[model samples]
Target: MKYTFYLKKTLSFFLFIPFLFFSCKKECKLSPAECHVYENSGSDCTKTKEKNAPVVASLKEIIHPISGSDPTLNMEELSAIGDYIGSAYFVGLGEATHGTREFFQMKDRLFRYLVQNHGFKVMGFEATWGGALYVNQYVLQGIGTAKKTVRKMKFWTWETEEVIALVEWMRAYNLAHPDEEPLQFYGFDMQSVDEEYFWIKDYLSDLDLDLFNSIDTLLKPYVSVADYQTYPSLSETRKNKFKADLVKAKKLFENKESNLVALSSQQEYDLIHQAFVIFIQNEDILDPKFGKGRDFYMARNSEWIRNYVQPRTKVALWAHNGHVTKGDFWAEGAELYEAHAGNYKVIGFSFSKGSFQAYQPKGVGLTTNNVVEEMDCQTVNALMADVGEDNYYIIFDELESTSAAYKYFHKKNPFFMLGSVFYPDSQNTFISLVNLPEHYDILIYFKESHFAKPY
Candidate 1:
């Protein structure tokens, strides 16, 4: 699968930096010591309500870096996160940007800790259900190559060495503990235009030829993204065709028709139907009135995985900050928080400044990575350095909304927001309004970071 480029259409300008460099730009050999966080109050940003709010004391103790990447080395710090997680069956690892190496590394390290220490039996990704199936097979059953299956997920930002390491490690863990239930991967993103067609083919692959053709014909318009790009007017046509086909798919998959082989599980059937739901509404997604329907479906799909699909009662979720943050913007994750009623805990990753990667699609068949240097600190991401650690976790649960710390964290600061696609030299790289305790239960802050190099 190719790197899907649908979500990078907008960006905030206040976070933009003057440097317009790409991946090959002069690499800085800056010292690790020099990278420690600093505050520049003069910069344009959301002034913290308690810029002087007494730095949290019980929470302010300096955090030490792990002796190495071995998550076991930092048991105390890792378990501290578990403290905030409480008894919630689900834990979310939300990243501020898609391509940060530290975010990826810490996520793998953190999840491993949870699985080993906390019994998080399954792990879910922010990928399409169809995209994640193959990787799940490879990791658990050893059915195919890990990297290639991950590539099939289509989100190039995550097709990295870091993820490959995480998958391989999970495989080893599963192999060592055959008697125990194995760790699994689950994808819950709203389907992009491509998977909607591919899933139809796969679902009907076991059907007789005539039946397959009849259904495929109705889905012909949205099969290739190039058609949409070349002929922008095809959106309405795509919507109509998908809606027509969706009716057929719903009828076929809903009833317990014993003869249905290719479309077996209600989960798989739901994925195909869900894809069409998002596909037909693509044109209206940008309209404020209609946009949230997309995110609403995202949360529903994920909650479906949690409530029905996975046998595991507990799970760990991985996704960019945009999808998982409790912000009012994305309805999918927000719906999850609403439905679970505090039964879920979200831990969002934040960064001050660093370069990260994105995909630039070269028409229909190809795409390339561009590591754009993140703009300067203007958000809560910047102020994190004051807590006095290279990396640390802040538990927001203790701060009530009426408290100075709470109001300060709620101010609209510009946090670094890059995902599957980004542009260097764009006016600003920030797309988030930093409301800390409200958006995430715990904030994992990385003062400085670098990009991930995918294998």
Candidate 2:
């Protein structure tokens, strides 16, 4: 039931994940790794500067205050961020809430700064690898409109004007740098594979119609019934058969790899091969015996990009804070950090308070509400809110070991976190205890959050 629930909730639709069963704030009993808090340690840090005066003062000394999140504005302040990244090969840019307009805009601004100043080449999203290939087509070749390309991503969280602006910016940058190395966009997730199937079918049909017929016949039965309950709910025997058929299809593709690559571009062959990989990922997600979650597979996909697909190329990944944190506990970025070690970095985002868009209970639509959770100084959100500026960025590695900010960040802090959905009035759902310094190497704090405008 745990596996089926996750499959139906994430793969079928509404794929915003890590749907943890949170404990009550009044008597929280969840483990420190899961709830991200130290038991009975809420008073470990000081609420006023009297007991922790050095911490606040240290934060002010090393913090770089930014003017605003507007990407079109002067970016001289953001140029300092590149110095912190140094030679890191992979950088994770995380959002506190998926529906924040300011966060989205700020990422756009930060990404532009990285591309223009640094030698970063690839931009990966927490989206489907197969669908993102189509988006890559539009950005590199002008094959489709920005709105249509983003919609192909199949996530309501990304169907926003803010995202579209970023996509168009990528295209514009590529066009302007015709002679230089153009930036490449990719998706590192494998949950949604509609676009994967389309590309695989198109490739097979064009080259080998008879082989295409056999594979399509096997896949046809499930196409019409691929709904929330119908697909992931398949019986054990049927699921095994489905996986066997996909394995056979992959073998068929592998046998013809040489001929396919000779006839078409290497890019085309790579697309179909990756599609088969995604099909296997889809099957594994449904099989409890696979013993892995989406985060593990997402980490593998991103690593594949850096190690296999584009070796030596630096990548900037965009995803939620939960997926991007590198804490000792569980997270996609944590997996990557373990594999890459000093070559990777995670930058976390945060907000004090304001209205932001979120999904309601059913599949109705998005709602905007102000979250008024009472946050004491023990939390990073409250501490950042007390800063002198409305916006600022901090690098944990830059702090002195004896600085108060270093000690404060090393302790447990209940950071405010939100996915794509939440109850209408449940502000407690947004609270999560996290060790800031361990989870993220850099931090960007916004004084207030604003709802992301949907396209």
Candidate that scores best on lDDT: 2
Cα-based RMSD of the predictions, in order? 8.7, 8.8
* Residue 435 C-alpha lDDT in model 1: 65
Candidate 2 weakest ten by summed lDDT = 1-10
Top-TM-score structure, candidate number:
2
Q: Model 1: residues >4 Å from true position, as ranges?
A: 1-53, 56-72, 193-203, 207-210, 225-232, 235-238, 261-292, 359-378, 400-407, 421-432
Return the clash pairs for model 1, or none.
Answer: 16-428, 50-53, 295-332, 299-332
Residue-wise C-alpha lDDT for candidate 1, range 135-165, written one tens digit per residue: 7767667767788889878887678888888
Please report the TM-score between candidate 2 and the true structure: 0.86
Q: Give the Cα lDDT of each candidate.
A: 0.61, 0.74
Put down candidate 2 lDDT per residue, 277-357, tens digits, no spaces: 877776676565653777888888887776544578788899999998899556889999999888888889988766567
In order of appearance, the predictions have TM-scores of 0.76, 0.86
